[model samples]
Structure formats: structure tokens, C-alpha cells
Target: MLLAGAAVAAIEILHRRYDGAVARGTLLDPSARRDRTDLDGTLNYLLVGSDRRPGESGPDQRSDTILLVHVPAGTKRAYLISVPRDLLVSIPPAPNGYGGGSDKINSAYEHGGGGEAGVRLLSATLARLTGLRFDGAALVDFAGLRQVVDLLGGIRMCVDTPVRSIHTGRLFEPGCQQMDGTRALDYVRQRYDLPDGDYGRQRHQQQLLRAMLDRAGETNLRDDPVRLDRLIRAVGASLTVDTNGVPLQDLALTLRGLPPDGLTGVQIPSHPETIDEVSYVVLDDGGDQLFAAVRGTRVPGWVTANPRWVTRL
Candidate 1:
């Protein structure tokens, strides 16, 4: 009887696993995502990551990553806001009863513990600067990102130049190739290969991200049980969300409403500029124009009514 009971439990677990996988794919409706019809309307999320290693021993600690996503309902258009990590900004007082002062926009995560603090600081900062209200925030570490690629069995990307820079101690060549967990991270994090330094690295990272998403659509992970389990575990382990904000189901629903290709990449404007006697990537005049378009209710005609940026490859 005990042996039979163990068998039953194992079967139940497997059943639940497959059930969740199917739900993640089929449960998503591509037409129902939109701002709430009642009260305050649509939702947007500020997805941010920090160079500051959370609970990890690392000398590198600061804000060096940001991605703002806008999701509206029943539309194919989604806006991706990529804010440069080095953008100079005033960091507000710590939300955890601790005080705060001015710091880079990315350091908000490190100053406050990880979840609410980071999200609050960013939401406040963006509202003051760009007039966009965030519904919630989610944070993912490099490991989580790596696992995501691995689950898809690696992503294929074309390297425009010979990527021979030593970053995090890995070297890659230029060409069309497939990247696993380690190589993907290395590709996204390298700065020495590009002449523009961090700004170039950010552009490469965004490209890598888009490539990964493209590859995912062609892969079996969306229907494969083992892969889905591993991917979810990795994401669940590394991701933290503000519970007082957008629920996962609601967020997923919003994501489902938008056709993947309709989303266009939006990077914060920055050209080289001197700040406090140090060279930094400062927002150009086009920066305000870009953010204004993002803050507006309608998607720009350039993005919504055109397919100019589509990757034909």
C-alpha cells in the first residue's frame, strides 16, 4: 500500500506539471489584454535589474540596468523602454525607514532591499521624470536570464563583428551562431568590443534579448514539459515582484494581448556628454521627445503603422 501511495503521488506531481505547462500556453488569451474598464485604466511595468548583487558577494554593485514595458489591452502594440543605467538622477530617501540621497537611477535597488523599495524608488523617479505610472515591477538576475535561454536549448544570433573581448572571462567570435547560458551572458555583458563602451553594450544586450525571444517562438519549450518546468523554476527562483501591484495572471494577460512583433525597442536617448568632469551618456534633446511619445496613450505612428524595424533575417 505504501508503494502504491508513492506511485500515486508521483503520478499526481507529473499530472500537475503538465497541467501547468498547458495552462501557461493555452490559458493566455491574445485578445483580452487592455486597461481596466473601470477606475484608473491600463498597466505598465518597470522591469529593472541592478549590477548590485543581491545577497551575493561581489565588488560590483550599482544600478546599471533598466527596461520599462508598456502593456495595453486587445492591441498588438507593446512598448519596450530601455533606460541607460548611467543616466544621472536624484535617488529619493530609502523607503525602508532609511533615508536616501542622490544616486544613479540603477542604484535604487541596492539602496532599498530588492522588491518594494526598488520598485517604489523607480516608479517615483519615472513619474517625476517621464509622467508614466507603473503598475508593478519584476527583477531577474543573470542566472535567471541564462536559464531562460538554456530552456530554449540555446538561441541563435548573428554577430556583426568579431567579439573577442575578455569580459567575465569569455571570448566569442563574430558570425551567425547559437549561444547557450554562459555565452549568452557573456555576449550581453561585454563592453570592450564596442567603441562606445557601455552604451554599445546596452544595444548589444537589447539585440540579444530580441533574438532570444525570436528563437523561443521557433522552439519546443512552449509545449515541452521538462523544459517548461526547468524554465519556471529558474524564473521563480530569481524573480521578485511587488505583491501589492500587478498580479501574475493579470500581467500575463496583458502580455498575451500584444502580438510579439508589434513591440518596438525604445532606448533612452544619449550622446556623449561631460558631467561633473567625467564623461557620461547624457540624454540628448530627442530624449524628451521619445519619453513624451511613450507617456502618450497612443502608440507612435512610426511604430504602430509600420514594420520598418522588423528583422528580416
Candidate 2:
């Protein structure tokens, strides 16, 4: 049943429109002129959650959520490493020929024009930071996330403590419960009220992801074509992939056998510090070790040794 949901999700992604340059270069090195086989090594995908709304425009448009998904060669397991948007890093010059400096990592996206150029700059920045090249890039609008959760009949999540959304003023009680689209969006967007701040929000985001996977396992998407179609349309409208030209179906097949337990979520190690009176997350030495493990495709070993870095979700 989970496989069917995965297939349905893949089909929806394939049917959706995508950018041309996302998958244009070598899988191991996006800047490489030559193409590389996806089967040869681990695949790294940069997933960005854009906070901008439809038709919204401004310099404030940034990736509120950034994750590097590492899929090992055999596709037996996958690792998701979350990069805080507030992480201070050096941004490369934008394709539009403006803006470059040490700032929040997400600044690259905003300065690069919020499209392919933004993705390129951000991907380059990530490559520089992690020493891992991207195989592909995916962008999901916040609006789409809400629709996807709602379409899946509201994902189930456990609130360890009462959560009052900083954005929406919505309150979530402590317990396992189903959340509608609006409620779910509010649930993941709150950070200020939590003790862990942004880290707590990150955990909620990861929890939402896990809930989606669990829902997929419980629901046979194929059995109800109508619901499946709605889901596909909702997802298609919200998600965009830069596959370069790799056939979407093939990529889907590569991921078909992935089990729920195979997915692991880890937070990039960082410490909070103020730079020139502005706050930022500075990657610690452990972060270097984590990225090295990712680049070496030895995340399982890294996780075993540094268990604290792994998110319990």
C-alpha cells in the first residue's frame, strides 16, 4: 500500500511542470559539464520550502525550510539533513549580477531572483558548505504543503505540549490528533512560543513529513482514483522539480522500494551567535563531520556515532 502511494506521488511529480536547468549537469557535481550516472553513487537532492505566496514578490522571499536529502546508491535508505535558514554563510554572486556576501544562507535565494537563478546560487552555496553536489533540486511552496496535508485527509501528529501558533493564533492541544490544512500549517510555523524556537519548528516539520508517509502507508491511494487525482493535482500545483532531463518515472522507480524505517532525519550541528548584532547559526565542528560523512556516503555510521544529532522523529 505504501508503494502504491509512493507511485502515485511520483506520478504526480512527473506530471507536474519543472524547470529545465535543475537536472542539466552531472549528478555528482552540478557545475560539471559532463553527465554522470545516478546508479554510480549516493544522490543528493536539495529541497527548498519557499515561504513566498503565489504572486508574492519581494526581497523577503526566502527558503524558510532547507533540507538536503541523501539517497544512498541502493535506495535502501535516505537521510534528511535540515539546514537552518538563518545559518550564516557566504553567498556566491547572483546570476543577475548583483549581491554577494556573508549573510544568512537563504539570502542567496532571495538575491538570485527566486527562480532558476536562485536555485543555482543556493545549490552552489550548499555545495560549498557541505562538499556534496546536488543531483536535483525541488521547491515546494508553503501553500502547496497545506494542500498536500489536507488532501491526505489531514496528517496525524502528536503535540507534546500546547502549541499556540505565532502566526495564526491557532492552538493545538497536547496529544495525537489529526490537523486540517490550515491547522497543520499553523502547527509547523510556530517557533517563538516553543522552548527550542526554530529547532522545535524544524522537528514539527519533520513530524509532518513522517505523518504524511504514515498516512500513505495506511491509505491505499490507488484504490480511490478520485482522491488520488485530487492529491496529484494538489501536489502538482504546489511542487516544482528541476530534473534537468532525467525521466521522472525512472527516478520514481529508483525510490519505489524505500521503507518508512529507512528514512532518517538529522539537524545540521550549529551554535547560535550574533554577528554584527544580527543572529545566525554557526556550524560547529560536528557539522563538518556530518557533511563529510554525507559526502563520503557514510551517514549511517555518522548517525550511530553522533546519535544526539539525529531527530527522534
lDDT of each: 0.60, 0.77
lDDT of 2 at 274: 89
lDDT of 2 by residue, 1-313 (tens): 9999999998676466332212332222256111454644678788888888987756568878888888988898888788888899988776588667888998878887775566677887887887766767777787667888887888888997787877767788899988888888888878878888777788888777778888877889889988887777677677777654567667877887877777888988898898888999899999999999987888899999988778766
Which residue runs of candidate 1 sit more than 4 Å off their true CA positions? Answer: 1-42, 52-60, 96-101, 113-116, 243-246, 302-313
TM-score of each: 0.75, 0.88
Candidate 2 to truth, TM: 0.88
> Which clashing pairs does model 2 show?
23-243, 23-244
**What shift in Å separates residue 58 of candidate 2 from its native position after superposition?**
4.6
lDDT of 1 at 240: 59
Best by TM-score: 2
